[model samples]
Target: MADLSKDYMSNSADPKNIQDLTTFVQNLMQQMQDKFQQMSDQIITRIDDMGNRIDDLEKNIADLMTQAGVDEHV
Candidate 1:
């Protein structure tokens, strides 16, 4: 519909147009940064969760080996 590329590439020499474009770009950047931060946080949380699960599994295996009288060296 609207020519977004033209609007973005238009000259920003006019005071009003410059202010508006600056505000728009700043808002867009902030929103993208926020989304990226959220995704990063989620990934970190999932990684931590997986680490905990792996640790639990390791401990459980150790316990099972001890109960079964398996040699630690083996």
Candidate 2:
């Protein structure tokens, strides 16, 4: 395998640099979380629309069966 430990050893200096790095990571994580929430909201809205359409279809089917003299209770 390639020497990965050497890369981590290179940045083992200066506490201020590490603090700045932590702040950058936290900001990135927050932005990612906001984007994820937006995507989830859109998915939920689409699911609700699909559910409404399915309900409409079910009602139409029942109406058609009734018009054809088919007993839905059977």
RMSD of 2: 5.3
Model 1 agreement with the true structure over 1-74: per-residue lDDT tens digits: 36876666665566889899899999999999999999999999999999999999999999999999997788
User: For each candidate, what TM-score against the reference?
Assistant: 0.79, 0.71
Global lDDT scores for all candidate models: 0.90, 0.91
Candidate 1: residue 58 lDDT (0-100): 90
The TM-score measured for candidate 2 stands at 0.71
Residue pairs in collision within model 2 = none
* Regions of model 2 farther than 4 Å from truth: 1-15
Please, what are the lDDT tens digits per residue for candidate 2 over residues 1-74? 24566655656555777889899999999999999999999999999999999999999999999999999999
Model 1 compared with the native: what TM-score?
A: 0.79
After the best TM-score superposition of candidate 2, give how far the Cα of residue 36 lies from its true spot, in angstroms. Answer: 1.3
